[model samples]
Target chain A: MGRWQPGARERLEQAALDLFLDQGFTETTVPQITARAGLTTRTFFRHFADKREVLFAGEESVPERVARLMAEAPPSLGPMELIAEGLAPAAAEIFEGRSLDYLLRRRAAIDAEPALRERELRKFSLMSEALEQGFRDRGVDDLTARLAAEIAVTTFRIAVARWLDQHGDPDLPATINQTLAAMRHLTSHGGCSPFLTTHDEDHHRRDTGQLHDG
Target chain B: MGRWQPGARERLEQAALDLFLDQGFTETTVPQITARAGLTTRTFFRHFADKREVLFAGEESVPERVARLMAEAPPSLGPMELIAEGLAPAAAEIFEGRSLDYLLRRRAAIDAEPALRERELRKFSLMSEALEQGFRDRGVDDLTARLAAEIAVTTFRIAVARWLDQHGDPDLPATINQTLAAMRHLTSHGGCSPFLTTHDEDHHRRDTGQLHDG
Candidate 1:
């Protein structure tokens, strides 16, 4: 048997997710997670400070990468575009081809448990702050940077939902681009209706008043 | 002594905020809070399920009002506009004349404490879901409704931050409306540039040239 042994961390996370899904997050305990993973309690502790950390594996790198991208991006880009560019590759790497079932399950678990939900929000808030700092580093004003960071996050979320619904077939980068385009359309044309002048409105009303009234 | 007694819940909240601000949220406990409030443990528990609940007393009514406005709004308004209109009055009613010191302190507490931050995110998620449902109830499709809800939340966050910074002096409704207008402008202009062709060409050159050089 020349194969590399499974790391304690990996084993612990897998066991935790399984237990969390099967027995529910509230019912699952650290000792049970460690035992199922064939690791000692000390090993579990060494890997994760607490049980909740198991559900949040790999999230730490997301903000770092996003910050790096924003720092290295072209200076000429507008605030929103710069933030979007910074997030695109990171989103592509972390989100593309990811298991929707796993994500949906994790979301459900968080929704069902108050503690887990709080942890998830803390992660999001950290991400938002990181993005805002990135924009500020590029000389954007505080309020504008904060607003742009928020819009970027909003686009990321909308893209993720769209991607998840499509069974994660679309590349994350493309999905983000498409969502931005849709946002443009939404904000610009106000959803497929031409701007109506007051004259046109009155004439139309006069022309169709009986039809509408009846 | 014909002095009126302060409400138990309000007393508890004031005491909790003071203690949490002074000693930090983690270091504070129920008994200490109740003692500070000059109330019994039973009186404290009657109002709040836990110490943390005391910090977030008005969160429930904000969402309820937002949802009600969304539900009762006229059907002809665009989804985003409808959400904006729904949130504006609520913001005016709830946020005007609010003390920035308490808000800033509360935000700091939440940021410093992981549990509180997560609870805040859960609240945000609930608001987003409520907004989505509101749009759906008005006959909007699922995807569009979700997108609109996200954008609305983003606008709300920006408006809130701006309001907080202005010493809580700006009319919340006007600030919200202005933020929505800014978002619309940013999204509609397609990267916020007048010289689109040149901008795209330069962007393409940078992107492709980077790829080729790498």
Candidate 2:
């Protein structure tokens, strides 16, 4: 209820989120959401396909939008740079203007429900494919493009989780930048990284790991 | 059943897979699976929680095993090296000795079922956390550990996807190594990466991306 002034769709989203968190996603119905919103069930149906869809509104299209952004990125940028640069705006669009209280509750709602979590993960998989397509369409090599898409999505997801964990202070785009920096820091180091370059070394370390655990 | 020489667990697995593929996951029953395997419901229950659980045997403990391996990795290895070295053994233990046909069919069954796919995704989430713990235990910083863990899981998942897509020919560990290499390649690059280092640039690129799409 904190400064959430909006249109019918936003109102419906808020109402559905409230019902979802209060009574649990499984127990809450469209009728309940509509009643809570002081709108008609027709309004609920107009906004979302079903009760579950209320939580994942716009998720299906998010990947497509992000993919298009990736396609439009300057070829001069590295993949990590492209992803950090491309995904930041979409992250801001979805998360920046929203109330922190509104988002935490929504995240809680999705986390509490298995079905919603599943839907979110499915969307992530779809996002990865769409991101890969974005890179492919821009003439990046297959392996490089695929790796970048997956890594970008992973970085974005981690940044969002961190933003929430930190109570949403530094803005989503900044958090993404922070995560992008850390990700680069982790991968850019190359001291002992011909790891598992041979099967014998792989076996030796694996057996040693097991022996220590045992 | 080709070259699947094993114990009760494997027989139940094969029988359950056969039924799941022959019929949809939702349509299959534990009793039917047991009947197909010529085992009793007692044995079936002894091995699985439900019909759905048959598709994800040993998945719950995989993260723990992986985490232990990470903890046991040489402290001198870089986090990237540690993850590659740690994850390969478990990957081998799960996928190496198994028949390619059996593995492919198993993947197909899980992919065809939403619930199974959900369960699998949940396992990956858990693996990310376990991997994070593995890194944390070894004194990696919070951001680097989290980024590395999430990135490692993503790399493993993509590698597995590639292995399956390539008809499971190369050993799973080989696929994982290749994927790890590609992931490193994606993140290691520093050029143009000061990605979204500034907010004004982020907004500019975002508006441009939108304009092009529009």
Candidate 3:
């Protein structure tokens, strides 16, 4: 009825990720992960359904979680406004408590495997669909809802990517905000030179309450 | 290397599509497809590498084709400008001569199968990568190149979906243009009500040469 080991799941995950990094994903086995985790194979099976299954579902129900967060948002906010003010924060918060290094390792694992990559893409696709439905339920028009949802997911993707690149700031929320600004700027101005504008300037402006909350 | 039957490829494709629709993708085989088209299995093998292969590559090398077209585009165009003016037109032209009905059938077969859907997504993913590289080759910065490329794919996806919905007009290039206008307006204006404004209005405006070729 409960996790008897308390942290057995996390330990197994960490050990598997390390093994995936060191010995390769296909080369790693369940018993190997269990031994590395100092847990039994039974415990590993209890934590994960199978080997590839462990490659994902670290944040299982992610799409539903995002949709649930957006559901609590104000109904009056427009598509872009909801995305920037609502979904961005929610998305950033979802990954806030997790270890950035662990995330980077997880990303490497997914990236190295085509099957895992497809599964990741499918999860994001589902998230987009959920967000689209949330916007529609919030009274946004059809096309705008679809556009907003797609852009929301895209913004999350780009923001997380930039954050994980490791050369930039480690603040995930700021990176998310910065990514939203970049999207709005690119779409609005149709220019590329000003893309070099630092997120700090936009961050300061947003701090002064300059959001277009239509 | 020249085909003895000039129409053999098209016949195999169409017959395979029809069979996939009638008897389902798994149920239909190469022999059945050839039989339906009054051709030999040799001809089928000559065309498609396998059964699932027919489910995709109706326009094989699409990403390369797009990147090649964009390679010839002027370097002065901004990211969004290149996408809207250069890439959109090029994408539309690539699908211009094909029959919409055949394309619709192909879409159905792909959508009906998860493997096919993932393959389709992978193709589009490759297309986005190709487009991103094209923008970078033109000297656009990294982030903007990614945004432009991703948005280009998204716009193409939405426009084609609307076009295939078959409720409205069938001129795909115009639909592509309309999608661009919508993206710009959404990003620039941040409002949802005006999304109801028909593409015809923007069509007339573009017809009058109001393009922002930044």
Best by lDDT: 3
Q: Which consecutive 10 residues in model 1 chain A have the weakest lDDT in total?
A: A203-212
Pick by lDDT: 1 or 2, better one: 2
Error of model 2, residue B135, in angstroms: 1.5
Q: Per-residue lDDT for B126-201 in model 1, tens only?
A: 8888888887788776767777877888788788878777866666777888788677645643334433366564
Query: Which residue window of length 10 is worst by lDDT in model 3 chain B?
Result: B199-208
TM-score of 2: 0.81
- Tell me the TM-score for chain B of model 1: 0.81
Provide the lDDT at A74 for model 1: 87
lDDT of 2 at A191: 27
RMSD of each: 7.3, 9.6, 8.0
The number of the candidate with the highest DockQ is 3
lDDT on C-alpha atoms for all candidate structures: 0.72, 0.75, 0.76
* Chain A TM-scores, candidates in order: 0.78, 0.81, 0.83
Q: Which candidate number has the best TM-score?
A: 3
Ranking of candidates on lDDT, top first: 3, 2, 1
Where in model 2 is the C-alpha error above 4 Å?
A: A1-6, A75-78, A190-214, B1-6, B190-214
lDDT of 1 by residue, A1-214 (tens): 1234457666787788888878888899999998898777877776677999887877877788778888888887887566556667767666554467777666666667777867776777778888889988987767667767777877777787677667667866788887876665556444423344565446334432312543
